[model samples]
Target chain A: MLADQVEKKAPVRRRKEARPQELTTAALSLFVEKGFAATRLDEVAARAGVSKGTLYLYFDSKEALFLAVIREGIVPIIEEGRKLLVAHADDPVRMLREYLFGWWALFGDTELGGVPKLMTSEAQNFPEVAQYYVREVILPGKALMREVLDRGVAKGVFRQTDSELVTHILMAPLLHLALWRHSFAVCCQVPDMDPNAYLESFFDLVLKGLAATPEGGK
Target chain B: MLADQVEKKAPVRRRKEARPQELTTAALSLFVEKGFAATRLDEVAARAGVSKGTLYLYFDSKEALFLAVIREGIVPIIEEGRKLLVAHADDPVRMLREYLFGWWALFGDTELGGVPKLMTSEAQNFPEVAQYYVREVILPGKALMREVLDRGVAKGVFRQTDSELVTHILMAPLLHLALWRHSFAVCCQVPDMDPNAYLESFFDLVLKGLAATPEGGK
Candidate 1:
């Protein structure tokens, strides 16, 4: 009788375990498409092939759902970046390159690309959400980048400069590229800008720019 | 009687001449504060110290008013850039530096700083506006930067890189700074970031990066 009961509940438990990821994935696409205020909970449920009741069980509110999406989808990518920083400890130059390219491959090139545009569009209206993103996503990401730059400088591969400022510079183009894709690229005739080529040029320009050499060496 | 009539008409003419500008300033602030779709016309008129009737006389619609704002407030700045390019014809480096700084001073540092945020937020909702901006502002700006890069390469002051890609790279940071100010800075405790210092670092980085020398000169 005990074995029979355990086997009967196993399938239900397995399906329940997968619900949050499915729900957050559904929420991300909707948030990207319709923005935060306009997207309805029912639509998210319908998109995820679940009922409104099921969504409510997983996330009490839209804000909670958004936070889960960030935690589940975005934080993992940032964690991977931290791991890469460790893995490439001795080779700061290669580490920086890999980290940037890895960001492009994992985040910028994915559906997650829409997050930057979403945050830019709605951050003012939702202060708590903005605060959460800054605290969780942006600050941590910047810290990771700062570590890379610091390592480079210490290794004598990069010039001594304000790592904080350089981190901002490194991120600006990538964020702008993502913002352009979701905003103007959606509505305007933004001539085909290949993302890979853009990243290549960015990497080439910035790496050469940051190299340690005599001032006015050229 | 003629002198009296001329005096009476002069003040009216002067105020009328300034109405469009006043109205646009009001509209720009409101649009930046509340995204485009939410801003109402009467509030704009009220903010400008004019009646809705006066607003109608100047602009037939909200869209027309936004275009006028871009035309009256922004176009002149880009035009000034063109003149600078010509004025510093023999000095590509100074021209590039001046152009970037002038952009920060004339546009990014002013009320116009909000325009980039406005466009980023509402461009998908207003395709015509985005098209007009692309045609009138972005393309021309990119053309100007490309010319500077080309001139630099010709003068052997800058490296041989794709000017098109470089122009995009050149613009991303400045645009990102403006976006940060209008979006995240409003709500978050973004430690005091000096705009002038940021631009100086950017100029230093890129100019050195673009210097034509043997690869890996460092």
Candidate 2:
């Protein structure tokens, strides 16, 4: 009876369960390597060991596949970060450290790092994709950073500043690292910069800069 | 006699004198807008109000034309900044401020600003171009900043730090602004950032971070 029950599970249903993830993982690599416009759906399917028709079953168009790749790859990390934000509400400094390090570990230090370069490179060519990326990824990410800065200011642990502008400053170096990794760093070796050391330097400078001074900060 | 002298200057001499600059100017805009791979030499020529054959007379290839655009547009600025560095050798803070603001004025707030974004976006597609850029522009630019940082540290005006890593930190936001202007900011409106105000914030934060503490600082 157990053998018959196992056999009853349809191969199509089991395959369908795993297909979308496989498709997106394949697409992400191609998009990163070839950039968005140059990456083709058939190649993605071939890389995933699926037929082009099967990739279409999961995604209507290449654009849809791209959106899925981004959403699947990054949205979950952001959601997890949001949850961590609530957990670290009482300690803004700790929250800030975790957030930055967590980003480095999750995005900057991973294969997903290429997404930032891909988006930055292709955004002008595809306004719709850029708009969607800004909405789904950029805005939420900035909002989370803004919250961290706002909490620090409110707690008197950090100097009063423009949270919006400061958030952008905080983001710049991280994005720079990611862009460098995918582009110039591909050809040129920057031997001295261990990414961890670079991040440590960034943290030291930024923390010192943001710390509320004993003499009233300007 | 003046009219006769002017007439004696061949039409070809006059045309040749101005052609390179005009071609570079046109190529710069198109490269910034369409990216390196997509931009055509013919379009650069047409935009410069010259014929395709005339463009070939000055620049043998599109790649050569691009290198000229960068060299013509930016190399002199770097050389000028180098001269100013010697003049400000005694005052590192002033030198730093002047350097940052000078960059903002000359590159960040102008069409040349688009070069950083262009380079970042297409560095992979053209490794030779990227190598030339790094050698010509990036290396000299970083060397100037490193001199400022080294001077500041040696004079005990700024805290001792890794001049190399700190230089990258210093450069990131400026690159961010340029990249943003050419990419997402083209489609997405960030209303709060007046470039001057943003730089002001950056200066404040960085200066504070870099300042040597009264208690014989870290």
Candidate 3:
């Protein structure tokens, strides 16, 4: 009986550890599909194939679950970015390009794409979550971009400019592209506005703008 | 008695003509403050100093009032941009700068700033209204920018590129700035981010990128 109980407990412990992430993944889809205010915890549990009681064991409330979703979605990306930054520290231009595209491949191209739209949409209604996100996710994200820009400027590969403002400028189009895909693209279809093409064009223009000298032997 | 009654009737006709604009202005504030789904028609009427019945006289439903707000907010800006475009047709670079900064002065600096945030937040939930907005506002707006870019490219003042994609790239940062002001700026105070300075920097980098040759004899 003891041996059988130990065997059962091993799987239960593993399942318990995994429950929070599974719940957040399910919650993210629902939150994105049906704005945050409208998504119920019961539905999240149902979508995750867990009971409401199981969800409560992990998250105390709907807001808690929403925060978890955001944190879970972003924290991993930030960690991956840090690793990429270290790997490509020697080449700031390449580092910058890789970082921008890497973000799209990991976050913008995935269901996590909806997080920005979701946060922007519901942030006003949920100030605490907004503040927390800005402090935790946004500031760190900006810091990472700023570091890359600073490195480029230091290397004299990029022009000397305000890294803070430039970071926002660099990010705005990409963020807008993601938000547009999830929001207005439903109504206003510009057939030529492919994400890959847009980002490529954006990077081309931005890199040229930042270069200390004009390309093409100018 | 007949002369007095006629005088009163003249004022009533003028007031009736102004009522729709006044009602939409009030509704715009409420919608921006409280959001679309949460805003009550009766409250909108109260804010406008009119009764619910009077609001219904101009707008059949809350959704109608919301559409009216969008239309009223954007239509004037579009008309003004058209006039600017015609006035500055000779200098595409100056025209682009004027148009970009003019947008910030007129729309981004006003209560109308909230419209982008409001629309982006609610567009998915209100597809018909979004469709109408795209038809009435967005496409025409993009056309104005495209004309500026085309003129620049044709004059060899700017590099040849996909104007459609470039138009969006140009507009995204501007739009994002406005949306950010209304959304995350409430909590995530990036103290260094002065809007005018940000736009100035954006225009500088973008204009530099588009120039047929690098500026400053570099």
Q: DockQ values for all predictions?
A: 0.52, 0.54, 0.52
Question: What lDDT score belongs to each candidate, Candidate 1 first?
Answer: 0.84, 0.84, 0.82
Supply candidate 1's per-residue lDDT for A51: 81
Q: Write candidate 3's Cα lDDT for B1-218 as tens digits.
A: 45754554333233678889888988888777657876788898887777789888888777888888998888778888788768989999899988788888888888988888788778888888887877777788788999999999888888888888988898999998988887788756556479888988998898878878645321
For this target, which candidate reaches the highest DockQ against the unseen true structure?
A: 2
Model 1, residue A16: distance off in Å is: 6.3
What's each prediction's TM-score? 0.85, 0.88, 0.88
lDDT of 3 at A56: 96
lDDT tens digits by residue: candidate 1, B149-194: 9998898888899778789989999999898888898889988678
| Model 2: lDDT to the true structure | 0.84
The TM-score of candidate 2 is: 0.88
Per-residue lDDT for A8-69 in model 1, tens only? Answer: 44342337888999999999988876676667899998898878988999888888888887
The TM-score that candidate 1 achieves is 0.85
lDDT of 3 by residue, A98-192 (tens): 87888888879889988888888777877888888888877888888998988988888888888889889988988988888877786566464
Binned by DockQ into CAPRI classes (incorrect, acceptable, medium, high), candidate 2 is medium
Query: After superposing candidate 1, which stretches have Cα over 4 Å from the reference?
Result: A1-23, A38-42, A49-68, A214-218, B1-19, B50-65, B214-218
